[model samples]
Each structure stands twice: as C-alpha cells, then as structure tokens.
Target: MTNDRRVIVHPDKPALASSVAARFLTKVVDLLDERPVVHIVLTGGSIANAVLEQVAQSSARDTIDWQRIHLWWGDERWVPLGDAERNEGQAHAALIDAIDIPEANVHAMPASDGGLTLDEAAEAYARELALHAPEGADTPVFDITFLGVGPDGHIASLFPHRSGIQVTDATVIPVRNSPKPPPERLSLTRPVLNASDRIWLVLAGADKASALGLALAGASRDEVPVAGIKGRRRTVFFVDREAAAEVPERLISPDY
Candidate 1:
C-alpha cells in the first residue's frame, strides 16, 4: 500500500474473494478473447482457496477453454505431489478438480520425486516459463498473479527482514528456515512477481491488522514484504473488514 494508492476492503473474506474472483474472470475472458492463451500464477492460503472456489462456481467459468489456459504456482512446499499440504494439491481441490485444464498445461515445481535439487527446481521452473511465454515477454509473463498476504505482512515466501527480497536472477528459489511452517519451500522471487501484468493480494483475519497497517503506512521494504509490490495501477489488494480494522477509514472501502 502507498499513500497514493487506494485499498478495496470488504466485510468478510468470502465477500472479498467473491468480488475479486468476479473481476478476475472478466479479465480472463478478455485476455482469451484477444489471444489464443491465458497464463496465470496461483498462490496458496485460505483466502486464495476461497477465491479459486468462487471461480469454479462462476457461471462464466465454462466459457473459457480450460485447456488453453496455462497455470503455474507462485510458491510451493517441498513435498510429494498430491500431498495434503502441497499448494498444488489444495488448488486441485478448489478449482482444478472442477475444470478441464490439461495436465501438461499445469506446471508445478519439481516435487520430491522430480530428481532435481532445490536449485535445479528453480532453474527448471524458469525454463518452463521461457518455453510457454510469449516472445519478448518479461521474466514472469503471467497475465495475472494471485497472492496472499500473511499475517506477518509476507507475500509468497518473501518474509519480512529476510533475504528473499534481494533475489535478482532466479525467478524461483528454495527457501529454508522460513519464519512460517514447512520451512523447506520454493517461491517466486520479486523479480518474477514484478514482471506480472497484474497482482491481486487477498488478505483476511484480525491477526493481520497491525501488519496490514504497517504495510499501508509506507513501511520499509525489508520490514514488510508486501511493500515489494509495485502496482503502478496493476496491483490491487482484497482485505476483509477485520483485517482492515487497524487501517484508517479513508483506506477502507465504503461498500464494506
């Protein structure tokens, strides 16, 4: 959040997710209508899962050719494919399970069985993007990247006061000793995140108030990972009332 930017807050997580999903679908349809394919980077967490569920329930969902849509993860816990805790597994339960997206189009990071080291996984994901992305496209090449704001003001695996922010080369990196659980994880660095056409940050819960307030108050980038988002009009935040209670009235949406 910046002094010049506006925040869109809803009364609850469900409402926030539903509203954002509706808007996201419109963009998806427009992209497909103009091009042969659409690419998106997905994230994990409860709010994101809710958004995906809403997407699955949307009437316009079936209008898009699912097979023409390419999918990639913004981060992942280093675990077996389909493992209960894996972000890919959670996404499958929410949206992918209900869609006809092709297996080849869904690109996930190397699981434990991929026979690649953490560094290798990072390189492999980058190669995957290079193969499918349009010519001259930037690092990420994602049409839309969905993210979740952690209670600590972290986005993806970029934790506050952590070294993930300085990553410049590899779009993906293996994270060890994450302040959150599942220490061994892989995440999309800010370089890749900033290259996206659009970024939607979905945050909820009262526990996130202080961090949200700090983030919106122009906190230092190293202290609040959310500050890494450079929208220029391409970024938006979806927050529930409880999560925004600490924020000033001017920052909260009137509709909420």
Candidate 2:
C-alpha cells in the first residue's frame, strides 16, 4: 500500500455529499468483484448523513450485494438504541432503513439502555471486533472508512488536546467529559481507524477551513487529530470549497 493522500474539493455541501456517495457505491461494487465481504467504518455529522441519504436514493446502490457489506461506526454516542441523537439512528433513517441488509451485518455500538454501562459497552464492542478479526489481527480489516472532520479538527470522538486521542491500548476507547455533547461516547481507536484500506475524511463549511488547512499541512496529531490519519492504501480529504480555503492548489485533485 502506498499510503497515498489526496484532496478532493467539491463545489458545495451537496456536491461533496453526492460525489462521495457515488464514489462509495462504485468502490463497493468494485470491492465485491474482489472479495465476498466488505467492512466499512462510518462516521456521523450533517455532511455524513447527507452522503448516506444520497447513497439511499442513488439507484446505483443496487449494483452491489447489500448483504455482504457490514457497516460499523467510527464512534457512537452512548444514548439509547433509537434516540434521535444516536449516530446509528441517524444512519438508519438516512440509509440503513431503506436497504435490505441483514441486522447482523450492522455492527452498531451498545446503547446506554441496553443494560450495559459505558465501560461495559466499550469492552463488549472490543470483543465483537476481535471476534471478527482476521487470523493474525486484533481488529477486522476495514475496506473503506468514512470519517467526518469537525470544525475543531476532531475525528470520531477524539477531540483535540483530549487524553482519549493518545489511547492505543484498546481497539475501542471510552470517551468521557467530551468537549462535544452527550459527554460520553465509544470510539474506535486511531489505530483501528488508520488501519483501513482507504480513508475518506470529509468536511463542509468555512468553520472547518482552519482545521482542514492544518490537517493537510501535517499539524501535530494531538492538536489536530485528523492530520494523523493515514490509510494503508489511500487517504483522501473530501471537502467543499468553503472548507478548502487553505488547501494547496497543487493538492487539489481533479479526480480520484
């Protein structure tokens, strides 16, 4: 794997969502030609949800085998199963609900109402990940990992300057007293996220311009978490023009 990095700038939020969604579908179709199963780590954010909605509506979605695609979250708020604030819930409404995938294929993190404490849920998800791990690996090899970058440069639940950002001992880490809402969350550690074959980091808005610039400029991982992510094969920053303010013209790729 080359560990290649690229910047894809779209015209606006809608363009970013639709382009990424179409790319996702085509990638899945191509992967199915090489393997029987494909695991994708998904993230949450308005832009991410928009992309999922695009995936749901695109007729091109029917080109791949839905059952072979396993959806995993990069991080999840420890809210109840169907809570409106839960990432899984948003994903369900945006894409999963309209698809014919099996319940077993959707690997959602535990809910607070599921009788498991936050720590318990984290450990349980870790065990589940290990169960699906390849023979010599501790975590499953994700084919494509979709992540949404926060305006502050956070990826998943790993906020800048947070202690959780340094944790590599666990595949899934429990985040507490988070700067973002809901306070508690379960997130796949950076190693897991970085281990994916392809990483798609997306952002949309002027608020994200600073973070996006720092990330592409190779800022400190502790200060800008998104900067640390590097996929085994390809790592791409998919941003709308508003968020691409500081991106170098040379890095602005015209196509994938």
Candidate 3:
C-alpha cells in the first residue's frame, strides 16, 4: 500500500454512506471546475447504493452540470437489461435516473439482452472505453472510481484465486462463474480501474472486517483483490465501524 492510503471509519452504515456521498459530490464539483469533462467509475453493492441514494436526495445534486459528467461501472452482471441483478439497473433507480446526466454520457457495459455473448459483451465494452481513452490507450483515464469491497476481499468481479484477478493486459474481461451469484459478469481489469486519479473503496458491516484487515495488512493480490486496488493519486477506504473492527488504528484517519 502507498503512504497516501487512508482509512476513514464512520460511526455506522448510515453515517458512512452520507459522508461518502458528500465527498463524492464535492469532489465532482471541484473536478468540474478544473476540467471540461469528468468521468467516474461506479461500483455496485448495498453500501454503494446507499451512497448513491444519499446523492439523489441531497440538494447538492444540482450544484454541478451533470451533462458534462460521464459515468461508468467498475463491473456489471451479464444479465438482461432491467434485471434486478444488473448493477446498472440498481444504479439507475438509486441515482442515475434522478440526475440530469445525458444518455450519451452514461457509458454502461453491454447487457446480455443486447444479443451479445459474454465475451462479445466484454469486447464491446472495451471498444466503448477506447473511444474515450487517450491515444494508444485501451481505457479512459477515469477521474474517480467508486468500488465496494466484498466480505470475501473481492473488488469488481475479480475474486481471489480467479484468473480475472491476474489479468492486467486487458481493458475489460468476461468473468465466468464468479464466486458470487449470477455467475457471469463483465469487469474492467485492474489496469483500467487503477488508471483512475482517486479510488474510494466503500464497505460496511462486521462481515467485511476480516477482508478489510487482510487487505490493509498487504495480502497478496492473487489472494485478496482489494489489496491491489489503488489509484494514481489517492486511495481511501470508507468503512463503517462494524467493518473497521479489524482495521489497524494506525491506518484510520482522524476526520473527513
């Protein structure tokens, strides 16, 4: 881990969600002021959705020009569009639909319903990313990437001991039989996720304590995907007290 890594512990889940949401909005506002366009990669999970919901409910949602912001997902279930298992579906109901962002700016991975096989879907997503990426790059330089740390120490669809976690050359890859349910998913590779300027990993509950501990302890990337998660500038773990139980006090930041 880098010296820039920070662990922020909140009193509880609600507090954690609220703080992350506020930070997200403020950061995006600042990015908008500094650049013409900003791209963010979002993750899916209970805590992640809670944060998005908080953003939708806040009056600060109107502070930025959503039209200039582009949103992408860190990973997505390879299910039909509108399926409850789809991350994009959960995201739309939680925040996207409530925001004023344009349809063209929302870069979602291809869905199974789009008549593409899992491999084809992954290829299509890579192509989409390349369109916005810099010259000679396969993926875009994401501004901020929001990721959820699984209790199993997985991030995106890259689970422990999985071949997907070992891949660094691809922009996106198809994950078959993921340790978690729905089996199939399309995930951006670590190279792509790590390309971001800031990485915010969110987690809650006592169930995640063990994984959080392992990750911060410098667990091998092949065994703990979260251990390899980092950004170009800053990497932060936004965890609730329950999930912070095993996180060393030394890594915990004093305040927001």
Candidate 4:
C-alpha cells in the first residue's frame, strides 16, 4: 500500500470481520467523544454484512450512543422497500433493528415503489445529501465511509467503463445495466464518496484477488473503479489472505 493507503490482511474472513468491527467501534466511540453525532456510510456484501454482525456482537457496541449516530447507504438496489435483495433491507436485518437509531437518523436511498422515477429518486437523494452536508459543501463530510469492492473492481454502483464512472457533475445518480444483478440502482457519485474523512474497503474471498491487486497497483479509475476512491484523510483496505493473494508483498501488512 502507498503512504496514503493501507492494507490489513487477516488470516481469514472471520478474523478480518472481527478486526474491522473492533476498529469501527473504536472510531465511532472516539469521534462521538468530540462531537454530538457521527455520520457513517455503509456498504453491502457478504463481508460487509459480516462486519455489521460482528459490530452487533461486540462487547463495546453499547458504549456508543446509537441514537446519536446517523446512517447512510453508499448504494442501494432500486427495488421495493423491503425486498430481500435490497442493501438497506439486509442492513436492517443484520444491524439496524438491533440498535436504537432513530428512524430520522437512518437515511436510506429511495425505493422503486416510492412513487418516483429512477432519475427522480437520484435527484431526491442528492437533495437529501445537500440538506445534511456541511456548510459550503455539496455533500456531507462523512466521518467514515465503508464500502465493498466487487470482483469486477467496481465500488458502489460505479462499474468500469460505465457512465456512472464517467459522471463528473452529480453527487448521486441512477445506474442502469449494472454488470451485476438488479441492474437498476442508486449510488453516490465519486465526488460524494470522496468527500468522506476516511474510507474503509472491506473485502474477502479469492475471487477478489485480481481486482484487489489491480487496484493497489495503480490501475486507472476508468478501468478499475475501486482505484479511483480516496478519502480526504485516509483509505484502508481490510482483506483476508485469500483476497490479498494477488497484491504485492510490500503492500500487504499482517499487523492487523
């Protein structure tokens, strides 16, 4: 990993999730000590869900004020409100429902049945971001943004060689024809994601090795969307040995 980026390789998936959960709790607790509320952007995937579960099981989980935490999604499937495949739904099942966060504090992207067109939903989410954003900023300065990388090197809904990856003006946009299932989705644009103070990419599995390697090797954003992501303060990739298999030895740190 470069000076601006760091990689933490765990022995296995369970270990990776546990370590990330512990660090996440620490970060939230530390930030809450200095501020009234802490904002976080969450992602969806097997490993992402695993981390959430770990957080829920943590002994320190109750120390942080859940009601003072604001939750947001980095991306969401444009499905019905409670669809099984929807990221927001899965998140609620895995963590939200187990916590005390107020309904107003949970900012989920609009669902398809919300009486808004896909474009309209995107616009609405952008407006929401603008409303919560810090003064003089187009997006919120999230305390931390958690994301999961696709095997295709995509981050959020920005796929390689896609229009989402090329967009430069919008903070949120509607995505169509995603290489993965549920083609239609809503995702925060690169600028909005980069507005965060820190970004944590939680990844696992051998299938992701090639993409992880390419991203760490400085692949272009247009070719590897994950490569384009950088936080204002720090960017860290938490991966298990299987996922880090293809990354250079110099970039893989076992210290975590």
Q: Could you tell me which residue pairs clash in candidate 2?
A: none
Candidate 4: tens digits of C-alpha lDDT, residues 45-138: 9899999999999889999899889999999999998899899998998889989889999999999999999999999999998898879888
The digit string of per-residue lDDT tens for model 3 on 1-256 reads: 2448999999999999999999999999999999999999998988999999999999899998999999999999988998998889899999999988999999989888899999999989989998998898877778899999888899999999999988978889999988899899999888788778999999999999999999999999899999998898999999999999998898999884
How badly does each model clash, as a count of residue pairs?
0, 0, 0, 1
lDDT of each: 0.82, 0.91, 0.91, 0.91
Q: Model 4 compared with the native: what TM-score?
A: 0.97
Off by over 4 Å in 3: 1-3
Off by over 4 Å in 2: 1-3
lDDT of 3: 0.91
TM-scores of all models? 0.92, 0.98, 0.98, 0.97
Candidate 2 lDDT score relative to the true structure = 0.91
lDDT of 1 by residue, 1-256 (tens): 2234456888788798999889888889899988788889899988899999999999988988988899999899887776888999899999998999999988987886678887788788878877875687535367888888888888888898889977887777888899898788889888788777778788899988888888878888789888777543377677888888878777665544
Q: Estimate the lDDT of model 1.
A: 0.82
Instruction: After the best TM-score superposition of candidate 3, give how far the Cα of residue 153 lies from its true spot, in angstroms.
Output: 0.3
Off by over 4 Å in 4: 1-3
Clashes of 2: 0
lDDT of 2 by residue, 26-140 (tens): 9999999999899999889899999999999999977879999998999999888889989999999999999999999999999999999999999999998988889989888
Error of 4 at 200 (Å): 0.2
Local error of candidate 1 at residue 105 (angstroms): 1.3
